[model samples]
Target: MSRNGQRGQAAVPPAEFRSYYGRAVLKTPVWEWKIPAYLFTGGLSAGSAMLAAGADLTGRPDLRRTGRLAALGSLVVSTVLLIADLGRPERFHHMLRVAKPSSPMSVGTWILVAYGPGAGVGGLAELVPSGLRRALPGRLLGRMARPAGLAAAAVAPGVASYTAVLLSQTAVPAWHEAHPCLPFVFTGSAAASGGGLGMALTPVAQAGPARRLAVVGALLETAASRMLGRRTGASAEAYSTGRAGRLKSWAEALTAGGAAGTVLARRSRTAAVASGLALLAGSALQRFAVFEAGVASTKDPKYVVVPQRERVDAGIPVRGDDRAPAGGTG
Candidate 1:
């Protein structure tokens, strides 16, 4: 019963919520546009490397060539964006000094280190002049191509999914709440983007696998996206409101349209290219949407407070970890 003798009142969320000195309860992440862009490019690079290996093994030379070059290009962009965001290239190098399995960031650094050389060699091997392949050095490089590309492909899953893990393990409520599906969403987006590139770059006749990949990726992405929207948490509001909501709406439309186009494309090069472009746009938007949502959750104190209050009302234990993350002391 209410103090005024009313009963069964519905809880209404406050119009405004603020923390000490009007500052966010959690520090808004220092990350900016570059971080989200890096996430997309990293996923693209991983997907392309995996596609390249599959294409090469299947004897689809054109698809293999496109996938290899795309992977390398995406990797290069991913590295540059990461470096730019850090404001110091040496920070990345410094992080390489120690390997910690418990830290997603640390594991990601090692994964990149292992995957980079192989992707580099695989892509560069294609650039050798036809006449040079007869030379000893060129022949040696050529011989190294298959193994290098396959090795990179083997490591690509970690590259595609680590960003999701990194974001979720942070203090951000929106990211942490949706951890179960983030990896699936990211990997699916990566595959979709790679398949898009393959379709646009390769001839339609050789693009069968790309088409299949595009459809599968689209389905996985869509399903995981639904799970995110349906998950129980106040933080889920972050994804469905404001700028994030607009971007997510667009992402879903483009992904679905692209998949539909791919399925009906058949031998039409024009349709393949158009659909590929759409998928790429959708994948980029998806990253931005997730990034914006996490940032939004931190900015609004309700995301944290309401959840704890609800848990208390329901007689559920509120979870917490008082331990601060350990430094390089390890």
Candidate 2:
């Protein structure tokens, strides 16, 4: 009997409406902390590599060395995180076996394979003494440094942006809906993180470019995140309502405060350090927030059903996998 008013009506209506007892529409991702950690470290590495190439071209040896070391260290850490996330470290090697143009993960694996060696060679060149360059091998390595750095720099943007695309490729409502702006948000956060590292590690006199980059990155990240929220519609609620909301709020606050502090602390080393730490923390939190939001979106049946329902009502063809059961509501 229908609970609302009918005394003896059957539960099933004349029109068939079937669902899996409100089960989730998609499988929940099993990715854990390592993935977001990889995103942060990878972005930092890529941004630093790009900075290193620019510094080398501009004759800023100090900045170039800092950038190189940063890139190398972060890239190594990022690779470790990625391998850890694969559950079995050996699985990481399997990723190198194929190149799928349509698969962001496959493409990103190749990009990392290419970027890692270039960045490593460039970093090693910086560490080798000039006197050592008198040796044939050393001289060859030195000569290869600039070109390697340039090559790594060329692929750096892809490293920073591809993770966002990977997330967007998923069926999770929050992630897929924010595709247009996720790359921009992540790229900007990467720039901010790289700049923050530079400001923290380099002397104030040589940190001007880093400061500028941080400011620009902060602005872009903030703006793109806002745009993403707007574009996500109902999915945005997943980001705004729970643990995800708290993390994102913290990310925004820290990013804004850090940018302001960077500007105001032009001469104060202590303030600069504080601001730089804030920016780095903020960037990491943003990645975690995005991950959590996607998870949240997947848990709620409405997030899956509502959109599919709207499409049906509008006479739009739903994907075969997403189609509701015959005459079903969802």
Candidate 3:
């Protein structure tokens, strides 16, 4: 009823309403540049941990040091990047104050705290040669070190995959909509980054597995990128038309070159090292480009509203509540 004793028109149809640019149809991005650093470091740590475990199981002590140190170093770097991103680094401990399955940050915080110590212990174990540790009174170091490395190893791959879930679960335009590619892209990035670190540190005489892993990771990244480029509308735009496109192209070149270089690893270590470095550099650029494209997409109201409006008109209701009047009366 109207205040004047007449019935009021039904509320204006929501579809009739429109917003200017950057009004934020989607939620704000809680992440920042440090998020990519976190991604990069986490990937490296997990991949290195896996290699360490493999070396241990295969009875290769020389390879063990490479893996352990890589894992521990990456963990340290990742933790630092994460804290740097926080508004209050001292309050980072507040994240561990609870367990929130629905919150990616909470889950990731717990994973990092656990993985950091686990990998650190594994790496420190490398300082003691097995034979020397065995000569001790209780054979104590050997007994404790081996088991700790094994446990960290068991958790490493999960650490690699969880970041994928973390990003995909977010409302970021490019990330959430591209869940399938997120995991594969992240996994490949991790492997490539780890391979780079290994090649940089490990002796040429024993970098065969690192080379192989690099090749595999590069191939996966290239393939996933193609799919990402094919995504329709807004998501596709991120991968094909701007700085992201340039970065993706560079990533492709680096990935291909690195993977191909692996074939010469046994005979040409220099080539292998160069290729690994290229892959790592490419991965960093790719992460930066994705971050930029996501922000661009969300900042433009057209990108946010157009496709979503199409969906709503088609009865799909894909985006936020339309502010237009209802029942086609507007």
In the predicted model 1, the residue pairs found to clash are none
TM-score for each of the candidates: 0.91, 0.88, 0.82
* Ordering by TM-score: 1, 2, 3
lDDT of 3 by residue, 137-170 (tens): 3365556667777788777766776876776565
Candidate models: Cα lDDT each: 0.87, 0.83, 0.70
> Can you tell me which runs of candidate 3 are displaced by over 4 Å?
1-18, 21-32, 128-141, 318-330
Q: Which has the better TM-score: candidate 1, or candidate 2?
A: 1
Which stretches in model 2 have alpha-carbon errors above 4 Å?
A: 1-19, 129-133, 321-330
Candidate with best TM-score = 1
Candidate 3 lands at a TM-score of: 0.82
Error of 2 at 67 (Å): 1.1
User: Please, what are the lDDT tens digits per residue for candidate 1 over residues 153-205?
Assistant: 99999999998888887777788888999999999999999998898889998
Clash counts per candidate, in order, are 0, 0, 9
Candidate 3 displacement at residue 286 in angstroms: 2.4
